[model samples]
Target: MKIRSDILRIYQSLHTWVGISAGLLLFIGFFAGALTMFKQPLDHWVSPPAPVPAMLREQEINSLAQQALAQHPAARKGFIMHLGEHENTVATMSWTAGKPGRELDFSGKQWMANLDQEGKLQAKEELPSILAQMIDMLHRTGGIPGKIGDEYLGGYLMGVAGILYFLALVSGLILLLPTLAKDFFALRPGKNRKRFWLDAHNIIGITSLPYHIVISITVIVFAFHDQFYDSLAEVVYKNQAMFGAPPPAAAKPYAAKDMLPLTSIISKVKAEAGDSRISEIQFFGLESPRPMARVALVNPRYLVQGPEAGYLIVHPYTGVIINASMLPGKESTWSAIVGPFFSLHFGSYGGDMMRWVYFAFGLSGAFLFYSGNLLWLEKRRKVQRPNQPLPVQTLSTRLMAAGTVGVCLGTVAGVCFTLVAGKLFAAAAENINFVYLFVYYSVFLSALAWSYLLGAARASVDLLWLCVLAALAIPCSSVIMALQSPSSNNLTGPGIELVAIAMALTFIYAARKTGKRIRDETKDSVWSLQQIQ
Candidate 1:
């Protein structure tokens, strides 16, 4: 009995310390992940971009391919084309201009190109939804340059945090076992501070355990994507390039002499990918006229569930299907499981409803972290002398608080600002994103600093109000901008506008509750200071 008790105590202590260590990073990751969940919707809201139907007919491809090729003859050696989807309209192509890695300095080396909907020339400036793309890049790579160095580091941090988060969650549940026998829904706010905090944490965490588990596992897999991919290759491919996954094959720069009939190839793709709508196509080794072609087809409905979802492969010659496999049978069992893990993390395996569920759970995860900080602070206050100077907060705690609340509130504000800015600025303007990021951080930092200096009771009230105000602004800004803009169709502009309205309403309610709490507590002097000091 004594040995088991000691082991349990050790686990509890380890779990608490581990959670404290990784809490902040996990908060940021979860918050960022939640934003990523709505990236498509936010993209649409920001730029009011149109979604193109997945219709890659032979004639369309032929016209676009010819135009693209004529514009970049160098692409013949190695190139790829991504026909845009319902959410995006610009077709993108990339190719190497010379030998792999080593090219004549004076020669045009390697580059990428973008084409508009009608096989017309388009510049990178033409894509207005780049703001959302930029956010995605930041979320994925933490906006690293040269190589994905910081990204990998952040991934490691998130991975360690995820493991700790899982352990903490399990231990937390075990600790709450004593209370679980009572009313699980009890939220006895009138109880002592520790009891109240424990109750709140346990109730929220326990109720959301399934979601937490899923997010934790998926986050670790996502953060350590290299591991997942390596596992996939080891287990599924067994050293064979089974999926026609890209090979390192490249050709020396050569003049384009013979051109394949792109029209014929497009026809073949449509015929072969019957019923499954073609979302995009890529032409590889484009520096040579006879480049390898590949196409991707998505059934829309199936993709949101698992690997039974979509088909993507390289066709060595436009006419042949090189490698084909559904999500379930396409790779080894390991790869198959890993595929679903990716989808779940990105919320790509489900429809709009599932995405919203992910968003909610993500927000809840963030809330868990925020509550954790407060709980820790409250715990420390109990042992500290009243009216004495408080100990300095650790750098991690300060940063965690700043990042947690600042980023969350800033994201809400930033999205709103992007929508208004998108219409005011020209479609190609990259400054819209710059403005949004700057504005969001400015507001976030100001609010966080104010909270820290003012202390918890005052800061909580103030910052909570700030969140309410920012969230409320989303709808108001959307409405005002939509009314002023010429392109403000109800379906396009007002569709997202409605979401903003709902968010605002929720915030208003939160603001009222928080404000009332502040007013009521201030009536008592002790409750105003030392209860939370």
Candidate 2:
């Protein structure tokens, strides 16, 4: 019992340090991740509606393929038909600029032939909005770029952080075990501010323990997936042949114009795939001889593994099925295992409802981290005695307090500015990615600077108001667009505006409460506005 008590005390200290250490980065990951839940809708909100009157039907695709192939004979090298769902490349055929995903990050060198309003075939490349992509990049890489232009370095750091997070969770639960029955849901909001913050933190953490565990494990798994796959190949599945040979290049030359129609292939795949929504058609080995295409689909209901190709390989020349992995069909053990890993992490299985729920939980998690930092600061705060100058706040304590204000409210400002840029830029602006980088970091760094310069109490109230104003940009931009052209559908704009208003109101309330605490509190603590200067 004595050994156990000693271990418990050690773990208590460990939890405090570990939680503080990982809290800020995890806050960024969680906040960005929550926004990523509605990534598709938010991306759609930023994306322009499909222009050019006529849709890219199967008949017109021949012209598109011919035009693309003629312009770049390498279309046969590596090609794909982006049918609507793929971002920024709707009604387009993409040819390899580099080695596709391996050498290049995103779809490289895409060309789409669409009929103009005057009935002319116009070929152009499309670019994606920076707002949604920035959020996703922040979530995955923690905004940390990796070398090889391929690896995700932020994922590695976040993975390490996730492991520490799991440890902190375990240690926290252990420390709280003795008081479990008596103070399980306690929220003592009296004179002891530390008690109130600790109670709130504990309640939130304990209630969401399982969820936190799932997120941690999933993040870890995703971060090291490549290593796991390599291990599986070398050890458990060494003797087995998991996949078949790559489809051979065309055995005979074929004109791009003679490519088989798309509707029949889609119809056949559809009939076989149950209700899977056909998303992509990848054309392979046009450079070789035997050109083949794979039709990929999206499973809307009951399929947790949305990442599965759910595709069928067919000869585009003969319209004959080469290899069939049709929907509602059996999959290999590898895919069965790997599919759900990505699906659960990405929340791609469930539709909007699930995404929204995940979004709420994500925000709650960010709040949990912010609250944890405040609790730590409150616990260690130093007060003054007689007429002596106020005790200097420890550098670490001041830094943490500043970080909480700077990172949290600054992220709010950064995101709003990015969204405003996305909304206002009608034509694809030059250096928009650089613009995103500038806006976000400027706000974030400035907040940190101001936090230390002005001290915690003053900074908190001022930054929170800044947060409110920045958040207001979302709705204001939407309202301006609405007023300019009232006919636009504006589906995501209103919902996003409503949420922004609510968050602004939240900041207002927080600023007021923080102000009150600053004025009313007597202790010469970090939150107190009493004489320190």
Candidate 3:
């Protein structure tokens, strides 16, 4: 309690600089992360409107499985009994071919069955989630992996950022502790710019402090999970079971007489796993003596199969439950703890409502960093000479101004454009990812260049309007397609597009406000676009 003023001052400086350093990256992370909460839905929306094969009945599942195995021996190697099918879903009797990362190559393993004209079984792979995957990748990589030689390099940097953020949290809380009671609710938005920003930053940061802390810790875990596990094992377990699990049965192969039926395996899973929604039963290790099946279930109301939380492993041949995550009162203590962390980070614990809540919080979190950067620039405003050109200002602040406005707005446009592109290039599902990369990076880099060349104030204003156009283009494209063929447009995708446009319009409004600020308010600042000229 007897901390020195010098130490406190040092902490204050540390907090400011650390926050400013990671601000834009965190903004990108949070913004994209918010969208990722609804990644599945977005994946579905932008996915092909064409229907796949209908559901397989209980009797049909067994017959289909047998046929799949006979026709495609790779199905015996490892495949899934897909429990559900979507319009854009795919069905493969056998996973005969796949390259590294288990991305099925499908070059040799492709097969076709009786086409009932209505698709008795799924015909093709569901459209890949190009937009969602891109956003998710950017969030995880912090826009660094591609730039760096190694993909994990970006994650390593983000992990370091997490460390800095952890320090900022501690120092910030220390700074606010003495006045926590007084300014806990204090927000005076008078003429004082710092006061307004300080109030907002503190309010948002404090209220969501726990969430932020969770995010920081989880980001580190995600980026360096292997390291964390290795360190944890080395420090605590000493090669022992740090996290307990059901003992695996002998992996010896069994004959058909000894093996239990798939139905029996599923029944056991349902009984043990409770009211969980089964997703797919993944069969593996067919070449081995004892094949196994990962009975994957989607545990709604909790983070379940997405992170492999609640799963059951059955002997593939015998269908005997070798291991189950849902053993009654047998859940490992460490697993229980880790389960919620993944759930919280992925926002899969709750339903649609929770996703929306997370989305709002994520956008707010992005703003927290954006506002923090603005505050930094505002504080450094006095260090520059009056009416000095932006090029001559502190390189840090100038770069920050241009990079922030450019990258963030550019990402907005990139996403909107990619949505339209995903639809336009649905037929070329395999190559659509390349198009997404081209469009996204092109828009993103273009925005940064525009900002650096035209100046942040003007570029920011222009990009906001550009975002409006990009977003509106989605619905407009959908409408045009619908006019050409009414059945093609289902309105769900366009409805999302409309929402995006509505969101983009807010940027339009903000652009107007920013323009007013440059012309009417800012006089001696780099943001004073007219004055700078």
- Report the lDDT tens digits of candidate 2 across residue range 368-469: 889988987776654323354556566777778878888777777777777776666644566455666667778878887898788788899999999888
lDDT scores for all predictions? 0.57, 0.71, 0.70
Residue 377 lDDT, candidate 2, scale 0-100? 78
- lDDT, candidate 2, equals 0.71
Best-fitting candidate, scored by TM-score: 3
Candidate order (TM-score):
3, 2, 1
User: Candidate 3's residue-wise lDDT over 141-168, tens digit each?
Assistant: 6766443333456677887788778777
Candidate 1 per-residue C-alpha lDDT over 252-345 given as tens digits, one digit per residue, 9 for 90 to 100:
5334434466665556666656566655566666444335655666554443223224554544443555545542234444456555655666
How many pairs collide in each candidate, listed in order? 19, 6, 6
